[model samples]
Target: MIRLARGATGFRGPHEAPLPRTEAALFRAACFTAAMEARGRAGEMVPGEVQTFRRAALSDGYGRVFTALGHVHLPVVAFTTDPVREGEPVPGFADPPVWAQVFETAGLRVMGVKELMTPLEEVDVSELSPAELTEIRYWKPSCLGDVLFNWWD
Candidate 1:
Protein backbone atom coordinates (compact mmCIF):
# COMPACT_ATOMS: atom_id res chain seq x y z
CA MET A 1 0.00 0.00 0.00
CA ILE A 2 1.18 3.55 -0.73
CA ARG A 3 2.00 5.66 2.32
CA LEU A 4 3.64 8.88 3.41
CA ALA A 5 6.31 10.30 5.71
CA ARG A 6 5.16 13.83 6.42
CA GLY A 7 8.18 15.68 7.67
CA ALA A 8 9.47 19.11 6.78
CA THR A 9 10.05 17.66 3.31
CA GLY A 10 6.54 16.16 3.15
CA PHE A 11 7.42 13.09 1.06
CA ARG A 12 4.33 11.07 0.12
CA GLY A 13 3.29 8.45 -2.42
CA PRO A 14 3.87 4.79 -3.21
CA HIS A 15 5.85 3.89 -0.14
CA GLU A 16 6.85 0.25 0.06
CA ALA A 17 4.11 -1.36 2.11
CA PRO A 18 4.80 -2.57 5.64
CA LEU A 19 8.34 -1.29 5.69
CA PRO A 20 10.04 -3.22 8.47
CA ARG A 21 12.03 -1.34 11.07
CA THR A 22 15.26 -2.91 9.86
CA GLU A 23 14.61 -1.84 6.29
CA ALA A 24 13.49 1.56 7.52
CA ALA A 25 16.82 1.86 9.30
CA LEU A 26 18.56 1.16 6.02
CA PHE A 27 16.32 3.69 4.30
CA ARG A 28 17.48 6.22 6.85
CA ALA A 29 21.01 5.15 6.07
CA ALA A 30 20.57 5.88 2.35
CA CYS A 31 18.88 9.18 3.13
CA PHE A 32 21.76 10.20 5.37
CA THR A 33 24.28 9.19 2.74
CA ALA A 34 22.34 11.16 0.13
CA ALA A 35 22.30 14.23 2.36
CA MET A 36 26.02 13.95 2.98
CA GLU A 37 26.74 13.62 -0.72
CA ALA A 38 24.52 16.61 -1.42
CA ARG A 39 26.56 18.91 0.82
CA GLY A 40 29.89 17.49 -0.37
CA ARG A 41 30.35 16.03 3.07
CA ALA A 42 30.15 12.39 1.98
CA GLY A 43 33.40 10.52 2.56
CA GLU A 44 35.52 9.56 -0.40
CA MET A 45 34.57 6.33 -2.14
CA VAL A 46 37.52 4.19 -3.10
CA PRO A 47 37.62 2.50 -6.51
CA GLY A 48 37.12 -0.90 -5.02
CA GLU A 49 34.48 0.44 -2.68
CA VAL A 50 32.65 2.02 -5.57
CA GLN A 51 32.71 -1.19 -7.55
CA THR A 52 31.56 -3.13 -4.54
CA PHE A 53 28.63 -0.80 -3.98
CA ARG A 54 27.71 -0.73 -7.66
CA ARG A 55 27.75 -4.48 -7.75
CA ALA A 56 25.58 -4.70 -4.66
CA ALA A 57 23.13 -2.08 -5.89
CA LEU A 58 22.81 -3.76 -9.29
CA SER A 59 22.91 -7.33 -8.08
CA ASP A 60 19.17 -7.54 -7.39
CA GLY A 61 15.94 -5.57 -7.02
CA TYR A 62 16.43 -5.06 -3.32
CA GLY A 63 19.85 -3.54 -3.99
CA ARG A 64 18.09 -0.35 -5.09
CA VAL A 65 16.67 0.00 -1.61
CA PHE A 66 20.12 -0.57 -0.21
CA THR A 67 21.46 2.20 -2.40
CA ALA A 68 18.54 4.39 -1.38
CA LEU A 69 19.35 3.69 2.24
CA GLY A 70 22.94 4.53 1.53
CA HIS A 71 21.75 7.98 0.52
CA VAL A 72 19.80 8.36 3.75
CA HIS A 73 22.93 7.61 5.68
CA LEU A 74 24.77 10.29 3.72
CA PRO A 75 22.09 12.71 2.36
CA VAL A 76 24.26 14.25 -0.32
CA VAL A 77 24.05 10.97 -2.14
CA ALA A 78 20.28 11.41 -2.15
CA PHE A 79 20.69 14.74 -3.81
CA THR A 80 22.99 13.04 -6.22
CA THR A 81 20.28 10.50 -6.99
CA ASP A 82 18.63 13.69 -8.10
CA PRO A 83 15.33 12.72 -9.74
CA VAL A 84 13.95 9.48 -8.40
CA ARG A 85 11.64 8.60 -11.30
CA GLU A 86 9.57 5.49 -10.89
CA GLY A 87 7.70 4.34 -13.98
CA GLU A 88 4.79 1.97 -14.05
CA PRO A 89 4.74 -0.30 -17.08
CA VAL A 90 1.58 -2.00 -15.89
CA PRO A 91 -0.61 -2.36 -12.83
CA GLY A 92 2.02 -4.05 -10.69
CA PHE A 93 5.40 -2.97 -12.03
CA ALA A 94 7.80 -0.11 -11.53
CA ASP A 95 11.34 0.70 -12.60
CA PRO A 96 12.92 3.56 -10.72
CA PRO A 97 15.72 5.53 -12.29
CA VAL A 98 18.12 7.76 -10.42
CA TRP A 99 21.22 9.86 -10.88
CA ALA A 100 23.17 9.06 -7.73
CA GLN A 101 26.49 10.10 -6.23
CA VAL A 102 27.81 7.36 -4.00
CA PHE A 103 30.28 7.76 -1.15
CA GLU A 104 32.13 5.25 0.98
CA THR A 105 31.97 6.03 4.67
CA ALA A 106 34.80 3.68 5.54
CA GLY A 107 38.39 4.41 4.56
CA LEU A 108 37.68 6.71 1.64
CA ARG A 109 35.55 9.88 1.54
CA VAL A 110 33.68 11.98 -1.02
CA MET A 111 33.65 9.21 -3.63
CA GLY A 112 30.15 9.80 -4.94
CA VAL A 113 28.33 8.08 -7.83
CA LYS A 114 26.73 10.35 -10.39
CA GLU A 115 24.33 9.90 -13.36
CA LEU A 116 23.96 6.31 -12.26
CA MET A 117 21.46 4.31 -14.36
CA THR A 118 21.33 0.99 -12.58
CA PRO A 119 18.62 -1.07 -14.29
CA LEU A 120 17.21 -3.85 -12.18
CA GLU A 121 17.56 -6.88 -14.47
CA GLU A 122 14.82 -9.45 -14.20
CA VAL A 123 15.60 -13.03 -13.10
CA ASP A 124 14.24 -16.55 -13.89
CA VAL A 125 15.35 -16.46 -17.47
CA SER A 126 17.47 -19.60 -17.74
CA GLU A 127 14.85 -21.70 -19.51
CA LEU A 128 13.74 -19.06 -21.96
CA SER A 129 13.57 -20.57 -25.45
CA PRO A 130 14.78 -18.74 -28.53
CA ALA A 131 11.20 -17.86 -29.51
CA GLU A 132 10.41 -16.78 -26.01
CA LEU A 133 13.53 -14.71 -25.88
CA THR A 134 12.61 -13.19 -29.20
CA GLU A 135 9.09 -12.49 -28.04
CA ILE A 136 10.48 -10.83 -24.96
CA ARG A 137 13.21 -9.21 -27.10
CA TYR A 138 15.63 -9.93 -24.25
CA TRP A 139 16.25 -12.61 -21.68
CA LYS A 140 15.36 -10.23 -18.86
CA PRO A 141 11.91 -8.69 -18.69
CA SER A 142 11.16 -5.06 -17.89
CA CYS A 143 9.23 -3.71 -14.91
CA LEU A 144 9.76 -6.87 -12.96
CA GLY A 145 6.75 -6.95 -10.63
CA ASP A 146 6.51 -9.03 -7.47
CA VAL A 147 10.21 -9.72 -7.43
CA LEU A 148 10.93 -6.04 -7.28
CA PHE A 149 8.87 -5.31 -4.18
CA ASN A 150 8.44 -8.62 -2.38
CA TRP A 151 10.22 -7.49 0.72
CA TRP A 152 9.87 -5.38 3.84
CA ASP A 153 11.04 -2.21 2.16
Candidate 2:
Protein backbone atom coordinates (compact mmCIF):
# COMPACT_ATOMS: atom_id res chain seq x y z
CA MET A 1 0.00 0.00 0.00
CA ILE A 2 1.08 3.56 -0.58
CA ARG A 3 2.20 5.61 2.39
CA LEU A 4 1.81 9.37 2.13
CA ALA A 5 4.59 11.79 2.98
CA ARG A 6 4.75 15.41 1.91
CA GLY A 7 8.16 16.56 0.81
CA ALA A 8 9.78 19.50 -0.92
CA THR A 9 9.43 17.99 -4.36
CA GLY A 10 6.05 16.47 -3.54
CA PHE A 11 4.81 13.24 -2.05
CA ARG A 12 7.50 10.62 -2.54
CA GLY A 13 9.32 7.55 -1.31
CA PRO A 14 9.54 3.80 -2.05
CA HIS A 15 5.80 3.42 -1.52
CA GLU A 16 3.75 2.71 -4.63
CA ALA A 17 0.88 5.03 -5.33
CA PRO A 18 -1.99 4.22 -7.62
CA LEU A 19 -1.40 7.24 -9.84
CA PRO A 20 1.87 8.15 -11.44
CA ARG A 21 3.89 10.94 -9.84
CA THR A 22 2.71 13.55 -12.34
CA GLU A 23 -0.91 12.54 -12.09
CA ALA A 24 -0.70 12.40 -8.32
CA ALA A 25 0.72 15.89 -8.17
CA LEU A 26 -2.07 17.20 -10.37
CA PHE A 27 -4.65 15.44 -8.26
CA ARG A 28 -3.24 16.98 -5.10
CA ALA A 29 -3.22 20.39 -6.75
CA ALA A 30 -6.86 20.09 -7.70
CA CYS A 31 -7.82 18.88 -4.25
CA PHE A 32 -6.06 21.74 -2.49
CA THR A 33 -7.47 24.30 -4.89
CA ALA A 34 -10.99 23.14 -4.24
CA ALA A 35 -10.38 23.05 -0.51
CA MET A 36 -9.05 26.59 -0.48
CA GLU A 37 -12.03 27.74 -2.47
CA ALA A 38 -14.33 26.19 0.09
CA ARG A 39 -12.44 27.93 2.88
CA GLY A 40 -12.88 31.21 1.07
CA ARG A 41 -16.57 30.57 0.60
CA ALA A 42 -16.88 30.04 4.32
CA GLY A 43 -15.38 33.51 4.88
CA GLU A 44 -12.59 32.06 6.92
CA MET A 45 -9.71 33.10 4.68
CA VAL A 46 -8.96 34.29 1.18
CA PRO A 47 -7.10 31.82 -0.91
CA GLY A 48 -4.00 33.33 -2.44
CA GLU A 49 -2.25 32.40 -5.62
CA VAL A 50 -0.11 29.33 -5.26
CA GLN A 51 3.35 30.31 -4.10
CA THR A 52 4.98 27.21 -5.50
CA PHE A 53 4.38 23.81 -7.04
CA ARG A 54 6.23 20.61 -6.23
CA ARG A 55 7.43 18.43 -9.08
CA ALA A 56 8.68 14.84 -9.18
CA ALA A 57 11.95 13.52 -7.87
CA LEU A 58 14.91 13.29 -10.24
CA SER A 59 16.99 10.71 -8.38
CA ASP A 60 16.89 8.54 -5.26
CA GLY A 61 16.50 11.71 -3.25
CA TYR A 62 12.76 11.91 -3.67
CA GLY A 63 11.27 15.32 -2.89
CA ARG A 64 14.77 16.75 -2.85
CA VAL A 65 15.00 17.93 -6.47
CA PHE A 66 12.72 18.57 -9.42
CA THR A 67 11.69 16.03 -12.01
CA ALA A 68 9.15 15.80 -14.83
CA LEU A 69 6.01 14.80 -13.06
CA GLY A 70 2.88 14.84 -15.21
CA HIS A 71 1.26 17.35 -12.91
CA VAL A 72 2.32 19.72 -10.16
CA HIS A 73 1.37 19.99 -6.47
CA LEU A 74 -0.05 23.44 -5.90
CA PRO A 75 0.85 24.57 -2.39
CA VAL A 76 -1.52 27.46 -1.97
CA VAL A 77 -0.97 30.08 0.68
CA ALA A 78 -4.12 31.70 2.01
CA PHE A 79 -4.58 34.92 3.93
CA THR A 80 -7.15 36.84 5.90
CA THR A 81 -8.45 39.97 4.26
CA ASP A 82 -9.52 41.23 7.67
CA PRO A 83 -7.01 42.37 10.22
CA VAL A 84 -6.03 39.87 12.90
CA ARG A 85 -4.44 40.24 16.28
CA GLU A 86 -0.67 39.95 16.48
CA GLY A 87 0.97 36.53 16.82
CA GLU A 88 -1.83 34.85 14.90
CA PRO A 89 -0.80 32.55 12.10
CA VAL A 90 -2.44 32.77 8.69
CA PRO A 91 -5.88 31.16 8.55
CA GLY A 92 -4.91 28.15 6.51
CA PHE A 93 -1.53 27.69 8.11
CA ALA A 94 -2.75 28.13 11.64
CA ASP A 95 -4.34 24.72 12.07
CA PRO A 96 -3.27 21.98 9.71
CA PRO A 97 -5.56 19.33 11.18
CA VAL A 98 -8.50 21.57 10.41
CA TRP A 99 -7.20 22.15 6.92
CA ALA A 100 -6.76 18.44 6.34
CA GLN A 101 -10.22 17.92 7.69
CA VAL A 102 -11.50 20.29 5.03
CA PHE A 103 -9.99 18.07 2.37
CA GLU A 104 -11.37 14.96 4.03
CA THR A 105 -14.83 16.45 4.24
CA ALA A 106 -14.70 17.23 0.53
CA GLY A 107 -14.41 13.53 -0.34
CA LEU A 108 -10.78 13.72 -1.37
CA ARG A 109 -9.06 10.36 -1.21
CA VAL A 110 -5.45 9.34 -0.84
CA MET A 111 -4.89 6.34 -3.10
CA GLY A 112 -2.78 3.42 -1.98
CA VAL A 113 -0.89 0.86 -4.00
CA LYS A 114 -3.25 -1.99 -3.19
CA GLU A 115 -6.19 -0.20 -1.67
CA LEU A 116 -8.53 1.92 -3.79
CA MET A 117 -9.79 5.23 -2.45
CA THR A 118 -8.42 4.82 1.04
CA PRO A 119 -9.18 7.51 3.56
CA LEU A 120 -6.30 9.13 5.39
CA GLU A 121 -7.25 7.48 8.68
CA GLU A 122 -7.04 4.07 7.09
CA VAL A 123 -3.42 4.45 6.12
CA ASP A 124 -1.63 1.65 7.94
CA VAL A 125 1.73 2.36 9.47
CA SER A 126 2.54 -1.34 9.48
CA GLU A 127 2.61 -1.30 5.69
CA LEU A 128 5.41 1.22 5.64
CA SER A 129 8.97 0.04 5.07
CA PRO A 130 11.25 -0.10 8.09
CA ALA A 131 13.07 3.03 6.97
CA GLU A 132 9.82 4.89 6.46
CA LEU A 133 8.67 3.90 9.90
CA THR A 134 11.92 5.16 11.30
CA GLU A 135 11.36 8.43 9.50
CA ILE A 136 7.88 8.61 10.95
CA ARG A 137 9.34 8.04 14.37
CA TYR A 138 11.67 10.93 13.82
CA TRP A 139 8.92 13.22 12.54
CA LYS A 140 6.53 12.15 15.31
CA PRO A 141 3.47 12.89 13.23
CA SER A 142 0.28 13.47 15.21
CA CYS A 143 -2.29 13.73 12.46
CA LEU A 144 -2.97 13.42 8.75
CA GLY A 145 -1.50 16.84 8.01
CA ASP A 146 1.78 15.91 9.60
CA VAL A 147 1.96 12.85 7.38
CA LEU A 148 0.98 14.71 4.24
CA PHE A 149 3.08 17.80 4.89
CA ASN A 150 6.40 16.41 6.00
CA TRP A 151 10.03 16.79 4.99
CA TRP A 152 11.06 13.17 5.29
CA ASP A 153 13.95 13.42 2.85
Candidate 3:
Protein backbone atom coordinates (compact mmCIF):
# COMPACT_ATOMS: atom_id res chain seq x y z
CA MET A 1 0.00 0.00 0.00
CA ILE A 2 1.11 3.55 -0.75
CA ARG A 3 0.61 6.62 1.43
CA LEU A 4 1.51 10.27 0.66
CA ALA A 5 0.78 13.88 1.63
CA ARG A 6 -0.95 16.08 -0.96
CA GLY A 7 -2.97 19.24 -1.39
CA ALA A 8 -0.15 21.59 -0.51
CA THR A 9 -3.11 23.89 -1.65
CA GLY A 10 -6.74 24.44 -0.79
CA PHE A 11 -8.45 23.91 -4.16
CA ARG A 12 -6.07 21.48 -5.90
CA GLY A 13 -5.05 17.73 -5.76
CA PRO A 14 -2.26 14.97 -5.36
CA HIS A 15 -1.12 11.30 -5.88
CA GLU A 16 1.87 8.79 -5.69
CA ALA A 17 2.83 9.05 -9.32
CA PRO A 18 5.98 7.39 -10.64
CA LEU A 19 7.61 9.42 -13.40
CA PRO A 20 11.14 9.47 -14.70
CA ARG A 21 13.04 12.64 -13.78
CA THR A 22 13.39 13.54 -17.44
CA GLU A 23 9.69 13.03 -17.91
CA ALA A 24 8.94 15.16 -14.89
CA ALA A 25 10.97 18.01 -16.36
CA LEU A 26 9.12 17.60 -19.64
CA PHE A 27 5.85 17.68 -17.75
CA ARG A 28 6.78 21.09 -16.39
CA ALA A 29 7.55 22.21 -19.94
CA ALA A 30 4.12 21.08 -21.10
CA CYS A 31 2.48 23.07 -18.34
CA PHE A 32 4.32 26.15 -19.57
CA THR A 33 3.19 25.56 -23.16
CA ALA A 34 -0.43 25.12 -22.14
CA ALA A 35 -0.33 28.32 -20.16
CA MET A 36 1.04 30.16 -23.18
CA GLU A 37 -1.75 28.75 -25.29
CA ALA A 38 -4.31 30.08 -22.85
CA ARG A 39 -2.78 33.54 -23.35
CA GLY A 40 -2.85 33.21 -27.18
CA ARG A 41 0.95 33.20 -27.38
CA ALA A 42 1.76 29.58 -28.29
CA GLY A 43 0.89 28.23 -31.70
CA GLU A 44 -0.58 24.75 -32.05
CA MET A 45 2.40 23.10 -33.74
CA VAL A 46 4.55 21.48 -31.08
CA PRO A 47 5.28 17.77 -31.57
CA GLY A 48 5.10 15.37 -28.62
CA GLU A 49 3.60 18.22 -26.60
CA VAL A 50 0.50 16.32 -25.60
CA GLN A 51 2.61 13.45 -24.36
CA THR A 52 4.29 15.74 -21.86
CA PHE A 53 0.98 17.14 -20.68
CA ARG A 54 -0.45 13.66 -20.34
CA ARG A 55 2.60 12.73 -18.31
CA ALA A 56 2.08 15.71 -16.04
CA ALA A 57 -1.60 14.88 -15.59
CA LEU A 58 -0.90 11.23 -14.88
CA SER A 59 2.21 11.44 -12.71
CA ASP A 60 1.58 14.59 -10.75
CA GLY A 61 3.44 13.76 -7.53
CA TYR A 62 0.98 15.60 -5.31
CA GLY A 63 -2.08 14.15 -7.01
CA ARG A 64 -0.79 10.66 -6.38
CA VAL A 65 0.18 11.40 -2.78
CA PHE A 66 -2.91 13.40 -1.81
CA THR A 67 -5.32 10.95 -3.37
CA ALA A 68 -3.57 8.07 -1.69
CA LEU A 69 -3.48 9.84 1.70
CA GLY A 70 -7.26 10.12 1.72
CA HIS A 71 -7.31 6.31 1.66
CA VAL A 72 -4.11 5.23 3.41
CA HIS A 73 -2.83 5.76 6.94
CA LEU A 74 -1.68 9.19 8.05
CA PRO A 75 2.04 9.08 8.82
CA VAL A 76 3.12 5.44 8.64
CA VAL A 77 2.35 4.20 5.19
CA ALA A 78 4.29 2.76 2.27
CA PHE A 79 3.31 3.59 -1.28
CA THR A 80 4.39 2.88 -4.83
CA THR A 81 3.42 3.85 -8.39
CA ASP A 82 6.43 2.41 -10.17
CA PRO A 83 6.16 -0.64 -12.35
CA VAL A 84 2.60 0.45 -12.82
CA ARG A 85 -0.08 -1.79 -14.20
CA GLU A 86 -0.48 -1.47 -17.93
CA GLY A 87 -3.14 -2.71 -20.36
CA GLU A 88 -5.62 -5.40 -19.25
CA PRO A 89 -6.58 -6.08 -15.64
CA VAL A 90 -4.23 -7.67 -13.14
CA PRO A 91 -5.32 -9.78 -10.17
CA GLY A 92 -4.23 -8.06 -6.96
CA PHE A 93 -3.03 -4.56 -6.25
CA ALA A 94 -0.39 -3.41 -3.75
CA ASP A 95 -2.92 -1.45 -1.77
CA PRO A 96 -2.91 -0.96 2.01
CA PRO A 97 -4.64 -4.21 2.86
CA VAL A 98 -2.31 -6.28 0.73
CA TRP A 99 0.67 -4.69 2.40
CA ALA A 100 -0.85 -5.32 5.80
CA GLN A 101 -1.21 -8.99 4.97
CA VAL A 102 2.39 -9.14 3.94
CA PHE A 103 3.44 -7.52 7.20
CA GLU A 104 1.36 -10.02 9.15
CA THR A 105 3.20 -12.81 7.42
CA ALA A 106 6.38 -11.14 8.57
CA GLY A 107 5.15 -11.21 12.23
CA LEU A 108 3.86 -7.65 12.43
CA ARG A 109 0.34 -7.01 13.69
CA VAL A 110 -1.18 -4.70 11.13
CA MET A 111 -4.51 -3.13 11.97
CA GLY A 112 -6.26 -3.01 8.60
CA VAL A 113 -6.12 -1.57 5.12
CA LYS A 114 -9.14 -0.66 3.03
CA GLU A 115 -9.25 0.43 -0.59
CA LEU A 116 -10.97 3.73 -1.35
CA MET A 117 -11.34 5.54 -4.67
CA THR A 118 -13.02 8.66 -3.38
CA PRO A 119 -12.51 11.66 -5.62
CA LEU A 120 -10.30 14.51 -4.37
CA GLU A 121 -13.36 16.76 -4.29
CA GLU A 122 -14.73 14.80 -1.34
CA VAL A 123 -11.61 15.22 0.77
CA ASP A 124 -12.04 17.27 3.98
CA VAL A 125 -10.37 20.43 2.75
CA SER A 126 -12.10 22.42 5.44
CA GLU A 127 -9.55 21.03 7.84
CA LEU A 128 -6.97 23.33 6.31
CA SER A 129 -6.85 26.62 8.16
CA PRO A 130 -5.50 29.90 6.81
CA ALA A 131 -2.48 29.75 9.07
CA GLU A 132 -1.72 26.26 7.82
CA LEU A 133 -1.96 27.44 4.25
CA THR A 134 0.43 30.30 4.91
CA GLU A 135 2.85 28.02 6.70
CA ILE A 136 2.77 25.57 3.83
CA ARG A 137 3.28 28.31 1.24
CA TYR A 138 0.36 27.18 -0.86
CA TRP A 139 0.86 30.27 -3.01
CA LYS A 140 4.62 29.96 -3.30
CA PRO A 141 4.56 27.24 -5.94
CA SER A 142 4.79 28.23 -9.56
CA CYS A 143 1.62 30.04 -10.59
CA LEU A 144 0.44 29.09 -14.06
CA GLY A 145 1.12 32.56 -15.40
CA ASP A 146 4.54 32.73 -13.79
CA VAL A 147 5.46 29.19 -14.77
CA LEU A 148 4.63 30.08 -18.36
CA PHE A 149 6.81 33.15 -18.41
CA ASN A 150 9.61 32.43 -15.93
CA TRP A 151 12.59 30.70 -17.61
CA TRP A 152 16.30 30.80 -18.41
CA ASP A 153 17.64 32.91 -21.32
TM-score, each model?
A: 0.24, 0.32, 0.23
Model 1 lDDT per residue over 63-131, tens place: 333223222111222212222223311122122233233333431222222212223242343433333
TM-score quality measure for candidate 1: 0.24
- In candidate 2, position 59 carries an lDDT of 18
Scored by lDDT, the top model is: 2
Candidate 2 residue pairs in backbone clash: 22-70, 22-71
- Clash list (residue pairs), candidate 3: 2-79, 14-62, 14-63, 14-64, 15-62, 15-63, 15-64, 15-65, 16-64, 16-65
User: Better model by TM-score, 1 or 2?
Assistant: 2
- Candidate 1 structure lDDT: 0.26
Q: Tell me model 2's lDDT, rounded to 2 decimals.
A: 0.33
Which stretches of model 3 miss by more than 4 angstroms? 1-73, 81-93, 97-117, 131-153
lDDT value, residue 118 of candidate 1: 24
Q: lDDT of candidate 3 vs native?
A: 0.26
Instruction: Give the alpha-carbon lDDT of every model.
Output: 0.26, 0.33, 0.26
Best by the TM-score measure:
2
RMSD of each candidate relative to the true structure: 15.6, 13.5, 17.7
Stretches of candidate 2 off by over 4 Å are 1-25, 28-123
